[model samples]
Target: MSVLIEVVTDVAADPGVVFDLELDVDMHTASLRGSGERATTGSGRRRLQLGDEVTFHARHLGLPWRMTSRVTAYDRPHRFVDEQTRGPFRSLHHEHLFAALPGGTRMTDRMSVTAPAGPLGAVVAHLVLAPYLRRLLRRRAAHVKQVAESAGGRR
Candidate 1:
């Protein structure tokens, strides 16, 4: 069984600014309000391209989880996709889309994930992971909104 969830936020900034932030993996540490410090995977490697691997280390509920993902697809200033290489999930595919709107930009996140166990895992993920990821994205979106709009539209 597979579970998918999508979240959207209207950021008060252009897609260019927000898209840049998404590509900057290390900047994520500062994008969200709180998640502790973050370390870059390739440290000096700052290229966002297909097959680029990146790892994010963080804790949720005091339980540490390392998220390892690779850039699956990229469409400059428009859409980019990443998939989990190794993590709690059996598989995870995340697609990030950005659309330029009238006053700002509309960012959408779509995730397709397969939990470890089978039907049982799907149930647990729907009841837990789904909601959790939704909330996490919401919070992260809020931060991105602030960061993007703070500079009178830049970051």
Candidate 2:
């Protein structure tokens, strides 16, 4: 079974700035400091572009995990998508959308995740993974908001 998670955040910055920050690996790692997430391969420590791939290493649920994702879609300052090529889950797809707002920008993240183990995976995904991922996404959004607001909408 696949789980869909959607998150929205308002930032005091331009859509372009928020969009670029979202693709910065260093910013991502910093935002996930609690989980010890780090970019280990591919576009680590850099801004990602279309077709760029990044492998992340992190500790989740008390276990180490690695996921490699590639940027499959790109629309500067608007939207982008990344899908897992290799990961712990059966499949993972993350889409990020940005829109200009009167005061700032509205950022939305839509993630689809599928766990392994046939029927049992669906249960686990609903009961555990979904909530956990939601929190992580919230944390990431908060961090981005803070940075974008502080940087005055500049990259």
Candidate 3:
């Protein structure tokens, strides 16, 4: 079974700012500092765009992991999608949505992950991966919100 996770965050920044931050490789690496996540290939220092691919190396669950994802869809300041081309999981899809609010922006993340190893993988994905990923996403979102709301974050 594929596990789906969704998180919503409201930021006191413009939708354009939020969208640009979301695609910033440096910002993503900084946000996941606890995981030691960093881009190893493809777009590293610059922002990712449609048709761009990035390989990320990170330590997760006390193990080193690598994943390569390609941006398959992109609509500036609105929506984007990335799908894993290679990773531990059988499949991973992430969608980012941004909506402009009167005062700021609303950002939403939706992810679907399918593990390998048949039934055992499904059990692990539902019981273990789901919660872990949820927390990870939450932490990342909080970091983005904190950054976007700061005066220095304005573009």
Candidate 4:
């Protein structure tokens, strides 16, 4: 079974600013500092764009993990999609959406993940992975919002 998780965040910044920050590798690393997550390969310090691939290494649940994802879709200041090409999960896909509001922007993250081990995987995906991923995404969104609203983010 595939587990789907969605998180929405409102930021006091333009959609373009939020979108760029979302694709910033350095910002991503800063957001998941507790997880020790870092992009080890691909894209380097630059923002991700369509057809780009990035490999992130992190420690989660007391175990070291690595995942490589490719940016499959990009529309700039609007929507983008990244799919895991190699990872622990059988499949992983993430879509990020940005919409302009009166005062700022609304950012939405939608992720779908399928685990590897049949029924056992299905159970784990729904119970453990879903909640964990939701929390992580929320944290990331909060970080983005904070940065995007700051004066430095306007640059």
Candidate 5:
């Protein structure tokens, strides 16, 4: 089974500014809502780029979980895509789509995931993981929109 979640918001700023902020790890980390390790800890290889691999240490469902993602595509000031190199899911493909809106950029995040355990895993994911992930992304997307829109996309 494939799982997808998305959210959209308007930013009253320049698209370039919004895009730059999204790519900045430090700037992005500052706005992330969570405790302790929510902020990135890795250095040297911290920058996001094609073929660059990063292990994100985070918590979900009140338990510690980690995601190892490989940057498969990085089109600056436009779009990027990442795939799970390791972690819980059998496969994960996350694509970021952006379009310049009237005043800013209309950003859409598309996430597709395939679980393990064949057919049975799909059911388990729909019942348990899907809801948790949906809520988690909703919170995350809101944070991103707030940061982007408040920073005035022109900055």
Candidate 6:
């Protein structure tokens, strides 16, 4: 089974700033420090661009995990998409979108992931992966919001 997760965050910063931060590998690693996430390949400390691929190593639920994703779509300051090329999941797709709001930017994250295994994995996807991913995304979003808001808004 596939699990879907949606998260929205409002930040007192320009959409472009938030969008750029979202693609910053250093910022991502910093935000996910608790998980010991690091970029093993591709734009390690750089900002990802079109066709850029990144492989991430992290630990979750006390287990080590690695995932490789490529930027499949890029529109800048608007939306971008990344799909898993290799990972523990059967499939994974993530989209990041930013829109200018009244006084800030509205960032939305959409993630769809399917676990490995058969029917048993479906249960785990629904019971474990879904909630775990949700929390991870929320933490990442909060970190991005703080960075964007503190970094100052730039068009």
Structural similarity to truth (TM-score) of each candidate:
0.89, 0.96, 0.94, 0.95, 0.82, 0.96
Residue-level lDDT tens digits of model 5 in 27-120: 5445444733343423444456677666766666677877777778878768888889888899999887667877777776678888899999
RMSDs, each prediction?
A: 2.2, 1.6, 1.6, 1.6, 2.6, 1.4
* lDDT comparison, 5 vs 6, better candidate: 6
| lDDT head-to-head 2 vs 4, winner | 2
- lDDT string, candidate 4, 39-58, tens digits: 95475646888888989899
Order the candidate numbers by TM-score, best to worst. Answer: 2, 6, 4, 3, 1, 5
Output the better candidate (2/5) by lDDT.
2
Q: Which predicted model would earn the best lDDT?
A: 2
List the lowest-lDDT window of 10 residues for candidate 4: 146-155
Number of backbone-clashing residue pairs for each candidate, in the order shown: 0, 0, 0, 0, 2, 0
- RMSD of model 4, in Å? 1.6
lDDT of 3 at 29: 90
Task: Report clash pairs, candidate 2.
Answer: none
Compose the digit string of candidate 6's lDDT tens values, residues 1-155. Answer: 79999999999999989999999888889989999998954655489998899999999999999999999999998999999999999999999999999878999999999999989999999999999999999999999998888777744
- The per-model lDDT (C-alpha) reads 0.80, 0.94, 0.90, 0.91, 0.69, 0.91
Report the C-alpha displacement of residue 91, candidate 1, in angstroms: 0.7
Model 2 lDDT tens row, 1-155? 89999999999899999999999999999999988998964744499999999999999999999999999999999999999999999999999999999879999999999999989999999999999999999999999999999998832
Steric clash pairs (candidate 6): none
lDDT string for model 3 (63-150, tens) is 9999999999999989999999999999999999998887888899999999999999999999999999999889889988998898
Query: What order do you get sorting by lDDT, best first?
Result: 2, 6, 4, 3, 1, 5
- Positional deviation of residue 125's Cα in model 3 after best superposition, in angstroms: 0.4
Q: How many backbone clashes does candidate 4 have?
A: 0
